[model samples]
Structures are given as structure tokens and as C-alpha cells.
Target: MNKIRIGVLSTARIGRTKVIPGMQRAKRCEVTAICSRNEEAARRAAEELNIPKAYGSYAKLLADPDIDAVYIPLPNHLHVEWTLKAMAKGKHVLCEKPMGLNDGEVNRLINATALDPGVKVMEAFMYRFHPQWVETKRLVDQGAIGKPTSIQSFFSYFNADPDNIRNKADMGGGGLMDIGCYQVSLSRLLFNAQPRRAFGWMDKDPEFGTDRTFSGMLDFGGRLSTFTCSTQLAPYQRVNVLGEKGRIEIIIPFNAPPDAPTEILLQQNGETRTITFDACDQYTLQADAFAEAVLEDKPVPISIMDTFANQHTVDALFKSAQSDHWENC
Candidate 1:
């Protein structure tokens, strides 16, 4: 099989530290190029990552005819712009999470992809591709958890740096946009339903103009989900799914260790057992999934429509926080 030549759109930390290397490990994915705003920085990354080519600007990378796909790890606000541009250039795209700043941007992203149905576009939610989660879904489907009725998630990391982009409101910085997004996506996926309404409360950072702490509840018809996502709390994360018969718990739900084995706690019939997953790189899994989609003409796993629903729920949560009432999603 011919390898998919993938271009790294930016030298973002996630790209440099995790995703690019994972792409290199993925089957049929070649990390052929790296791009950054600074030519020197791009060259430095190219040398460090052992990429053959480097481009000083995103446009240059897009213009390269050799690139079959692009992994975009740009900031939250730039996701829509670069993804649209990359897809327009006939390049399949795997863009990082919170694919847009709001529902409107996601709608625009959907429209752009609709205009070019042949091009594959996916939101990079790496955790979804992990075997642990896959097994968890299988268990749920097989009624190990009976009928899943509710979910609760917590994702938090203490970050008070005012200079960080995650603290900048204009850059789409905030706990909700960063980590809460995962909670929302997880809830929807586990429930297999979109939220009908949402309620939220947030505490803003005075200096950063971003939410330091955010908590929200999502109503999925007969089921309900709640989450707390924070950038000012001690680092920890978990997801719990409750059903009529039993409950399922993901210990390191979101930021799972790439090199270490992980397990899920299953409690049913008054007994508890741990299901272990061998150490696996979800980033690599994500890359290979995208490569498979592009190379074999299959659909991208996480569709823009799903992203729109996630972002729409996020938007509704924020709106609910402002109005101090449940907001329709």
C-alpha cells in the first residue's frame, strides 16, 4: 500500500510532542513535512522530527502537491480557517479538538466539507480510538452495564499562566473549550444521543478573561450527564457511566498515558473486575484511522456533523451559564 504523505501544519506543542511522532508510527502515514510561521523554527522542527521538508508558512505547505493529508494542531480559533483551506486544496484533514470556537464555525466547517464530499475531514479526538474505550463501548453494547442511564466526568489541570494561549479568551481559551469538550463528546458517544438541553456555571479568571472553572449538566432525553472541567484545579480525570444494572468507570479517561497499560473498572452483579488494555498509542491509532479513510476511500470516523453537535452543546452550555437557566442544545 502506498503511504499517505502527511504534512504537519504547525509546530504546536501537541504536534511536536505527541501527534507527529504518533503519525510516524501509524501504518501508511508518513510525516513528510513540518510547517511553522518561522522558517528557522520550521527547519528546527524538521531536523528534530527527522522530516524531509519544512515550510515557513501554512500556505506553502498547502500548495505542496506531494502532501496527501494534513494534521492541524493549530490553536482553537484557527481550526476552521486552516481546515477549510487544507480541504479546499484537496488535502484530507485531521484537525485537533474543539474543531471551532463555536457552533457557527463548526457549521461553516461542515458546509466546507459538504462542498467537497470526496475529501475526508475528521476532528482529532484521539481518545475515541483507544482500545480501552472501544472495549468499553463493546461492553455497553453487550449489556454489561445494562442500560446506560447517566454519565459523569471530571477533567481538570491547574494552569494559571496568564500568557498561555489557553488563558486567552480571544484564542478560544478556557476549561470548557479545552477539556470540557471531551466530557461533552464522551457523554454523547456513550449515550448515543445528542443533548436536548444544558445548564452550566462558570467562574472566570479576572486577568485572563477565560473560565478558570466550569461545570455543566447535559440532558439526553431520559438520560442525564454532568461534568466539571477546570484549568485551575489539581490534575486529574475520570469518566463514570451508570446504568440500571451496573456502572463503568474509566480511571484515566482523557489524558491516558501513551506508553503504559490502562484499565477500566467494571462493577456488575455485586462484583468488580478490572479490564486491562495493553499499552497503546491512541494518537497513532487516530492517524492510522485517518490514513485508512483517505487511502481506501472510507468515511472519516468523527464526522464534522458530530463535531457540530458537540460544539452546539458547548455553545448552549455557555449560554446557559450566562442566562442562569437551562438552554436548548
Candidate 2:
């Protein structure tokens, strides 16, 4: 097939406003359907996005034989359940980040995929597909920053709405799972290895009973990475990669604007250089990459093993927070 048929599993804001639109623009995939628990909402989103079909329930959408793949933009708690269901139905999956709540959930997915090895599954970490990030990784590998040793990141936004899924702790809602995962994922990416140990500090919101702010450190033997994420703070995000001889700073790392140019600063020998990337949707790149993997019968860009490793690191950080000491990853 020249183009893979994709079905979106929800009317989540991220799907309607970001992922679906980007997938629609991808060359290797077509978003043919969208579904929601509420029939009216499903129909509304389908109509707005010009999708061919809308289903009232997720199972109904998954049952559609026409769909070769499914994108799960569901909440944190629902990720593993729906992904396993999709795999059972012989559908490729592109599930959103923080693939599962903990190591146990991740292991369940790992074991299930082992049984159905043909079905490709990937965690949606779209930032890594952006040209800026691609270039950053290339430069790091080429030793633009000699002997990379440390990374620091900060991501935060103000959201006090109790009704929002992010504030619902039972549903696996929290700043750490929502945004802090990015820090862990990128650290492993740049370090080209997993951290040996992790340490974390968290401040929970009394009303929400969810972590509103979180800070963590990952020790990759001689290298170190630190990050702070918040759900109740001024909107901001930036990442700095420091090496023995140079440093790289990402001005707006995570939520890169699709229409505007993005820039990164590279400093060396008392001079700073700005590297700019043209306007492009990382989501589109990510969708096309996953579609190519599905069409070519190749491994997905971010493997399930990598997803499990990231979750393992996150689990370690949470353990460290509770134990008030370092935890092995």
C-alpha cells in the first residue's frame, strides 16, 4: 500500500488540534477515521477533519478492517489497555508518550508484543523528529560539543483546572508523567546509554493529590542530567547540553511552534553560534516515519525496548523521591 490508513482513537485535544492535522499532512499515511465515547463528539471531529468514518466507541473504530493503524491519544492510564487491544486486532500502533504508568505495565506490553511480533508499536515522542533535534544529535555525535557530560532541562505550564485529565491522579495524571518523561528520554538519547541511578524531588498539589512540580537527576556513570517540570508555573521550556569544551542550548525545546523558525545556540571557545531550522511540523515527520516503518515492515523509530527503558528510569526517579535517596535504574 502506498499510504497506510490510520484511525484516531479519541477526540482528545492533542489529536484534533495537533497530531491528526499533522498526520493528515503526512505522505505515507491517511487519517481515515476518528472516534470518541460520545457519538456526537466523534461525528463532530470527523466532520471537522474530513475523516471518512466516526465511531461512538474505541472498539468500534478498532474493528474497522479498513484501518491499518491506530493512533492512541488517550490519557495516561488508558495507554496500555488500548494498545494491547489494537495489537490483538493486528493493527500497528503509535501511542502517546509515557507509554505506560510503571514498569509492570510496560513489561505487560513487552510480553504481549513478543507474542505478536509482526505488529509494530511505538511511543510518540515527536520532538526527536524535529529537524532541530535531528541536527542537535548529529552535532553531538560529531563532537561539536566535545565529550558531552551534562544536560539540564526545564518544562512547565500553568494549569489549575481540576476537570482536566492531567490533574486526575488516579488516571496517572501528573507533571512528571506528562512532561518530565521527555527529559529522561532525551537524556538517554544524547548520552547514548541508560543512567545507572536516579534521584528525584516532587511537590504534590494538595487539592489534586497529584505531583504539580517535579525535579530529578539521572546519573549516567560519569555523566549527569537534571530536569524540572511543573504543572502550575509560568509557561516555559529550555534545554542545555554541556560538554567539556562546549555547550548547546535549545531555546524552545519541547513544544516547538509549527509555523515559526526554531533556533539552538552552540557555544565554543568564548563564541556562540545560532543554528536555525525552518518552519516544519515535527508531528508530520513523526507520522511519516512510523508509516514508513509499517509499510516497509521495518522497526519503528522509537522501539518498544527504548520505551521500556525510559519507563524504567522514570520508575527509578519516583522511587528515589519516596525513599529520599538514589535508586538504580
Candidate 3:
């Protein structure tokens, strides 16, 4: 059995806490290298994770011929620039989401990937790979919810640490880019098309210039989906898909660790049912799925085009928020 030699671009929180660990546990992946801006940090992370190599500069890591792929968990803004650079080096890329700051950036990425046939690029949306969502999609498609009409999603956390990357403005830190993108992307997954329009408002600090909270409505061909996201306030994360006949509700949406079996709350006419499923190791599953795509030459489950459309909606929301009027999404 051959192992996929994987190098991580940064010792960022997600990379350190999840991606690196997930890659280590994946049967198809062999953690080859880890890099960070600080040499000490890189060394420490490499030692702790038991990775073979560590580098101070991203350029050094990318230049290594032994590495077959790179997982990037850089800030939201650097996603495109760095992913393209890695792909240019003939390395497959798994970039952390909110693929880019906007639709134009995603298009730029699409153009870049056109040059690398063998070096495929994927957005790391671990939630999408989880069996809970898969089962929800199945139930919805099977009419577990009759004619899925709406989706209500929420993701929030109190970010008191203003120094965190999620609060940095130039890094494209904001509730929308960090968390709302999940809701928006999930909204697209609920159906097969992009939303026709989006209306939203965001709260931001004058000094920080990053959104603290955001709530919005996405009209996917008039189905009317709504989502709320925040980084500076609240303690909640849930997603509910409502149809005419019933609904499929997830009590815990994101960050469902190893044993978190998301209870699928199904409520129909007069009676309610709850299905407890085996917990999905989303991060590991995500790594395996990407490996399958790379190893077997199969299509990625989540489409890059879909990433483009999600950015389109996000770009439009920023526009609408700026103008205080409904805008094309």
C-alpha cells in the first residue's frame, strides 16, 4: 500500500488541531511535513504531531519533491493565492473553507486549476463529508421531508480573544466568511441550484472592521432559506431543514468531534421521531474522500463550481449589506 505524502502549509489552529491529526489517522495519508512562519513553532508542531519534517517558510515546504499534496489552513483571504501557488507546484491542495473572499477570487482559482490536470484542488468542508448530512440528504431525497421548503441554520461563538485570526480584518476575518459561509454552502447543498437572491445584515466593530455577527435570507428558487452566524456572541450551532410535511433537524452541526452522533430530529404530522446514528469522524472521512478522488481519479463529492457559486452569494451579500437593499446573489 502506498501512502499519500502530505505536507501542511501552516500550523494554524485548524491545521494543528484537526487537519494534521486527521491526515495522521487517514490510512491513505502519510504526514510528511509541517510548516509555519515561526521556526520554533514549526519545530514544536512537527515534534508534537510526529511529522517527519518541519520548515520555517512555506516556499521551502512546497519545493520538496517528496510531498505529493498540501493542506492549507491559512486565513480566509490567503486561501486562493496560496492554493494556486501550491497547485502550480504540481501538488494537490485541500484548502480550508470559505474558498476565497468572493466570487471573482474563486473564478481566478478556477482559471489556475485549469492548468493543473493532475493536481486537483478541493475546499475542506468537513461537515459535508459527515454521514449525518449524507443521511439527511438521503431522507430529504426520499421525501422524509416532503418537498423541502426551507432551511434554518445557525453557527455562533463568543470570540472574546480579539487577537484571534478570526477577528483580523486583513485576513478577511468576519462572522460571514468564517461561519456564515458554512450555512450558505449548506444551503446550496440542500438543493441542486444556486440561490436567486440574498438579503443580509452584518454587525462590525468600527475599529476592527470585521463582522461580529450576521443573519441572512437566501432564496433558492423561491424556497426561502435563512441562516444566522456570529463570532463575537452566542452559544449555538444547529441546522433545521423544513419541508411541507416534516423537517430534519440537527442538534449539533459543526465541530462534531469523534463520537458526536448528530441526532436527526424528524417531526411529521402528529408524531415525532429521532434517529441516533454512529458518529462520523468528519475530518478523517474528508481526508479519505479526497484521497479517493486523487487515487482513483474520481470526481470530488463537492464541486469547485459549487464553491464558486457560494462565493458569488457571499460577494452579493457584502454588496447588499453595503447598500441596505436586496441584491442579486
List, residue by residue over 265-295, the lDDT tens digit for candidate 2. Answer: 9999989999999999999999999999999
Residue 152 of model 2, lDDT score: 95
Ranking 1 against 3 by lDDT, winner: 1
Note the Cα lDDT for every prediction shown: 0.93, 0.96, 0.85
- Specify the highest-lDDT model's number: 2
Candidate 1 lDDT over 147-263, as tens digits, reads: 999898999999888888899999999999999999999988988889899999999999998999999999988899999999999999999999999999999988778899999
Q: Model 1: clashing residue pairs?
A: none
TM-score for each candidate, following the candidate numbering: 0.99, 0.99, 0.97
Q: What order do you get sorting by TM-score, best first?
A: 2, 1, 3
Candidate 3: tens digits of C-alpha lDDT, residues 218-309 = 88776988888998777889999989899889877777777666677889995889988786578888988887888877777676887898
Model 2: runs farther than 4 Å from truth?
Answer: none
Q: With candidate 2 superimposed using the best TM-score fit, by how many Å does residue 137's alpha carbon deviate from the native?
A: 0.7
